[model samples]
Target: MTSSAPSTRIASKLGLSDRIFAGPRSRRLLSTVEAGLERVDAALVRELAMADSLANATSRYLYDAGGKRVRPMLALLTCQLGDGATDKVIDGATALEMTHLGSLYHDDVMDAADKRRGVPAAHEVWGNNIAILTGDLLFSRASQIMARHGEAAIRLQADTFERLVIGQMHETTGAQDDDDPVEFYLRVLADKTGSLISAAARTGLTFSNGPAELEGALTVFGEKVGVAFQLLDDVIDLSADPDETGKVPGTDLRAGVPTMPYLLLAQRSDTSATALRERIDDGVAQIADGADPELLDDALAELRDHESTQATLDLAHRWSAESIDALAPLPDGAVRDALTRFARAVVDRSR
Candidate 1:
């Protein structure tokens, strides 16, 4: 089920190799996607290379660290429904991936994170001001690429960018007094993660002239899959070893971020919940004040094994299933099958 060298990392990282090469048709599709990804990778290097040496180096930092390239792959996969990767589709894919990479720089800054893709975060290396500017540069470059595709692409890019900002704003502000914490968290996930993913899939279809009728279904699929992907990330935050996920376990908890498991725990009124709640509340404050690492580690271990974490995993599976269901309207073929497999793989991150 493994692939050869270059695409092997992407396929293994995403657990997509088996599904992608499952059948002869799927193998052909995989070859096509790998080829497009190669082009996208080249474009990433060329696009991020700026006349300003500092900007170029800073912007290229995360790109060189390596990522799963899921966004661009989603864009490429959807393009198979119509004509395969045309020049416009490749440009759109490149733009979408650039947008994703830029968001990571800003995200690490916002989270005060130390590492990304196994390297020091851009902010950690170059300082917040330089890191923020690098993100802006990449974002502008993405817009410039979209602009070449015409007004519609520009509008889509603008709208997606707006959603991304609003999502971060809501996450920063926290849920309002009357807001349902779970519902609010889901909305934030949709805005921050799902919106851009929907745009990525739709952009491929738009650029490659995929069937107009399937646009709505693919959009729904992308958004749901994106939410599922992030929810699984929430579970992974608690469960995955740092080596596996490339993130410190319980990083969100330490930051006082409201992950799905935490939000779910907040809703429980039973006696069993009281001790965990107290531990979390106290642990968060202590970690913020540089308290005992042993205490925080113990609390995180308990929370990771808690029922609430399992519930979050269940929700992720539900979303993944719903995403696959959205693909029901598409014809039965390799593309549809791969999309379904992708949805399942998105949730499978919990393993």
Candidate 2:
């Protein structure tokens, strides 16, 4: 398929455009990846196009808005260790991104989020029923693309889909009586965010004929890095200005979502946290009722400056370091170095 070179924004989003292109060899690899990503973009639009005009528009909505495309980038990067970006690898990357986009539509509905990627959420534009159906349509398209790759890819997609659903189910049901809330939250992050990422990394190996030994390492690396990424986002959610994050500060807290910082604060028995916890609870209730914006804003500002927020940041660094450690088994080279930098960037990203 014909495609243009990836834009600077797309390259920066993958965390490896200008920075990694220092040497001729590195520049060539970067060009290859850029070309592959362009193909992936084309494939996404082609596959998501529908016979019905309304269905086509809704399916293409999020794709047009753009995203980090981290999953597909990981898939393409790992492919460098093997046969590079083959047609199958490109298709695999496209399918993974489609699955991710589909999940976002469903996630927005569940979270009652008004916006995604700086635009109105699909649910907000088309109502919940159409949004949910659009997500299902994308999922079906992903499966159709995966089916072309073979049974293994299909199985991987199915397993990841199951994990995504199960993770959402647990999040909705909340923790069991004996469950440690912190542990429960981490598990949810792993299944919900990490599983698909792990699959994306593995798909590179599966499609590109990479060394089989590296598969498990990359999978673990992806999962740990995903969790670390989400943890960093927890900190960002509290600290990021609206312009940086494209969402209001304390959005999750206002929605009563149990973020890592909040969970950590809840575990503290210190008197300092007692007042903070009460205020947070009150803020949640107030926000839910659309009352007392000033009080909620004050509580959010307080929590943003709290020690638990710092603790959450520290935890993110720890996980990112663990993700780097997971790559110890791989041979030293540009691919491994790029992956390392990518993991670090996940925790360090400002937006």
Cα lDDT listed for each candidate: 0.85, 0.83
Residues 1-351, candidate 1, lDDT per residue (tens digit)? 111123424575476778655777677788788888888887787787888778878888888777888888888989988888998998998998898899999988888777788778899899999998888998999999999989999998999999999999999999999999999999999999999889988987888999999999989998999999999999888764776666677777777887999888888998777778888889888877887544677777888888998999999999999999999999999888888888897787644
TM-score for every candidate vs. truth? Answer: 0.95, 0.93
Model 1 scores worst on lDDT over the 10 consecutive residues at 1-10
- lDDT digits (tens) for residues 1-351 of candidate 2: 122323524465645565544455556667676777778887886888788989988998887776888888889888998999999999899888999999999988887776787788899999999999999999999999999978898999999999999998998788899999998999999998999898989998878999999998999998999899889888888764775555667676777777899999999999989899999998788768887545678777888889998998899999889989999988888778777877787787763
Model 2 ranges off by over 4 Å: 1-9, 12-28, 290-295
Clashing pairs in 1: none
| Location of the lowest summed lDDT over 10 successive residues in candidate 2 | 1-10
The reply for model 1, stretches above 4 Å from the true place, is: 1-9, 290-295
**Top candidate by lDDT:** 1
For residue 100, what is the lDDT in candidate 1?
A: 87
